[model samples]
Each structure stands twice: as C-alpha cells, then as structure tokens.
Target: MLIDEVPERAVRRAGAAIELPEGLLVLDADSGEFGRMPKPVADAKIRGLSFDGARMVLVGGRGTCLLRLADGEQCWYGIPEERYDEHADLSPDGRTIAILTCDEENAIISLLDPETGRRRDIWSDPGTASHECEIRWSPAGRTIAATYMIWDDEMDDDALSTVVVDAADGRVLAGPFIRTHLLGGWLTADLLSFREEYDDLHRLQRLDTTTGEVITGPTIPGRVWAAVAGRHVHEVDELEDHHAEDTTFYTTDIGFADRRPLFTLQPKVEVRYFFLAAGVSLPPSR
Candidate 1:
C-alpha cells in the first residue's frame, strides 16, 4: 500500500436539496472534497452517488443522471424531462448506468449510456411498487440488489422483500426476502454489509453474497453512526476523535477504475439550545 497521506480540507457546498430524496454524495478524489457542481433541481431527486473514480453518477428520482468531472467544468447528462425517481447504479466500466424507474404508476429498471445519453428499458416489473429504497450493485457488476415490499391485505401491513437482479439480463436472482427497513448497504466481491432500521434502532448485518447467508449476528450496538468499508479500513464512528493526528489509508484498485475518496467527511455542528423548544429533537452533548 502507498504511504497514507494527511487528510485534505473538506468542501461543504450546498447544491440542490430535494424532499424524500436519497442522501447520495460525490467526492473529488484528489482534494477529498465533494464535486463542485450547479444543482438545478427539476422533477428528479438525487438519491445515491456512484463513480468509476473519474466519472460520478447520481441516482434518484427520474433514473440515473450522469456527472462528469474533467476539465474543471462540471457537466451533466440526463434524459430529457423523463423522470425515474428511484435508486440508480452504474456498471463497473462506467459505460452503462442503471436505474429502478417509475412515473408514480408504472415501474421498471432502465439503463443508459452516460456519454451518448441514450436510454433503454431493460426490466419492467409491474408488481414493483413505487416505494422501494436505494439500489446496490454487486462488486462484480453483474447483479443489483434492491428492497422489495408488498402489502398482504390479510395481514393489513406491508411485507418487505429483497431482490437481487442479474445486471446482464435483469433476471431476479435471489430474493423477495422479508426484511423490516433497509437503511444503507454495500457490496464486496464476497461480502455484503447492510444496515436495517427497526423502530428507532439501527442494526448492521454482514452477509456472504455467494451463498446468501448471514455471517454475523444482527443488532450491533453502540452509538456507531457512520461507517465506510474498504480493504484497508472499516472506519466506524466513535464518541471521541480517534485519528485526529494520524493519516487515514485508502485502498485503491488497479487501472484507476475503482477509486474512492481518500478523506472522510467530518461535519461540525453547534447546537445552541436543547430541551427548550417544543417537540424539537436535539443531539446529545459530546
């Protein structure tokens, strides 16, 4: 591994903020900061961020939109006025991007080229409702996993399901598995980690993707709020700053294909008043 470098300065710039959108973020690899772009909100909301290192894509309302960072000018490529409003992901080569699409009534998974801006609908599942969460891609770029839920009128509540799709043909590979709430998820070549939300508590589970088996027990406890995994570090949130003076190591894949941001995002907030406001929630004092 290359020598770890000092953390670079963070750039906190507000782009477009949309309601009920995914909180996906993109970062500049060199500066370890978010990509500077003009966020003009249309009918779409950006829910997740994925990259081939050089190119960044935002997935959310209205399908997957492409973002390119090259000669200092940030450019965006998108479908003209057609909205997809769900989770979107990119292939490993950065040539094709995928999205779980709907227009408040019909739903399908679509793919598009970032450079040419041409789109094709690959999979249409009419049974899929418009209420699914973010979509995740397998590390090999061959499959996609998404949360699927259906209402059983006899039970009177929604039953959750998870589905994995074959990227090549949009074939259902694994689930429709029952789950409660899926918060965030990531995939490795062999391992898959996911956070599940239950009531007010969050649980993290690690799974073996090949066998579709759980490797660790559920409901890991603590105030662990933030987590990002790589080959070098599995950084978890702690009450106190652990690496204040030390450099953080970032692992990289060859061919510059899979490059992640080298710096961790740190946000400092000052809360002036706590329990005085009516029905206002406050963060615990550090």
Candidate 2:
C-alpha cells in the first residue's frame, strides 16, 4: 500500500473492497479518523446499507442483516444474534424489520422481530405485487414506508406505487398511490417526502404522517440535493466530447452534463468521490 509514496506490503483480501481484495473504508477528516468498513456482512456485497443512530441495516441480494452497531464497529445483540439476518426493512427503533419474502406460490410482507427472529405475516399481495426500494422507517419510528406493485418480472418497472404501513400490526395506513420514483425521504421527524408528477415536471412532496396532508417542495429532473452541514469533496468526470461548442446544435435545455455546477457526470463511467456529511465520508460510486 502507498500512503503518498510511503510503501508497505498489502496482504491478500485486505485492501478496499470484497471479491477483489478491496474493502470499503470510512474517513472523517474533521476528527482525523479513518478506517475500512468491516468486511461485508458474511462477505456478501451490500446492496444497501444505512445507519440512523440506533439501528444499522444491511441489505444484500442473497441475505440481509439487522444489527445495532456502536461506533460503527461494535455489534450489540444480547440474544443469540443469528436469526435476525434476513432480507428485511429495519424499523427506525431497531425493533421490527418488515421483509417482503415470497415462495414460488405467494408473496407477503413479514413483520420480523430481530431480537427473537419471530415473524408474522402482516400483508399479502393478491396480484403480483413485489417489493422495490425505498423500504424504510419513518423518522418517528411509527410507520414503515415501502414501495411495491405488479410488473412483468424481476427487471420490469410497472405499476410502481408507494404504501405506508403501520409498523405495529402491518396494517395499510395510507397509499397504494401512484409514484414514478422509488424515492422518498424523512424531510423532518414527522414528514415523509415523496416524488409525484407536478404539471409537466416531477416534484418533491411531503406527507404529514399525522394529519394525512400533503405539501409540495422543489421540482427535479431526476434527483436533487441539499446540504445539511459540512462540505463535499468532488472529482470531475468530463466527457471528451465536451468542448468549446457554444452552439452544440441541441433543442433541449442545459443540465448537469459537461459544464455543470453540482458535479460533472460522464456516460458509461461512475464518478466516485467523497461526501463529507456531518463528518462521515459517504462513498460516491462512479
């Protein structure tokens, strides 16, 4: 390994990611602390990972994990700690995990108790409703926000809709509403932000979980961002075709392409950088 030309021998499977001897690492420049992500859960590629103070959820293609981590490394489970691993959505309180599992014949959402690994069928799809992304806990920890709908098969995007389930009993509280994006947010502790069509463009709208009300926010092309704190360190990926072509012969609007402000994006390549949010260095994949 080379830390600015200081050479050192690196062992096999100990670098920066799995499957290729590479592992993920975390760095907090403000605190001057840096470390690699603990080897993937049981060495499985993490399809999704999120931490919200009390709970840590790791979602993968083969399996999933529900555990509480202290200081990002310590595993805190008083029980046997083996059965809570499943493809599930972790509740904000770290108590319940809502998993949509199916057999060759049926598909249902199973409300799972991570501590005991006990599960109960909360909801079932009569048609062909399968789960999609954005399965998460509301900031208040009372509602489970997820998306599911009928489609052709595994790779098809059709009839995508959002549902807010009651975490306690798995009751459908609100929505089966049409949504174009599998995107939602906890804009506030009680507000759940979702995307919907607003006129000719898509907009971000917040739903008040308590009052069944709605409030619209900014519009986006596909995605947008806002900085809560700290600053982001970025690397540009400009297209070779991007040059002094003020008259590039296009009948469309300008965007975050070559000459963009937020960040430069290129086709067929990923631009991974560092997002120093509140101290944690978030991995940006190119």
lDDT of 2 by residue, 21-70 (tens): 34443332333233445443654333233333233445444345643333
Which whole-number lDDT from 0 to 100 does residue 167 have in model 2?
A: 74
> What Cα-based lDDT does every candidate model obtain?
0.44, 0.43
Winner by TM-score: 1
Find the candidate with the highest lDDT and give its number. 1
Candidate 2 residue runs with Cα over 4 Å from true position: 1-39, 42-56, 60-62, 67-87, 104-107, 127-132, 152-157, 197-200, 221-286
- What's the TM for model 1? 0.58
TM-score of 2: 0.57
Model 2, residue pairs in steric clash: 16-22, 16-23, 17-22, 17-23, 270-286, 271-286
lDDT of 1 at 26: 30
**Every model's TM-score:** 0.58, 0.57
Note each model's CA RMSD in angstroms.
11.0, 9.0
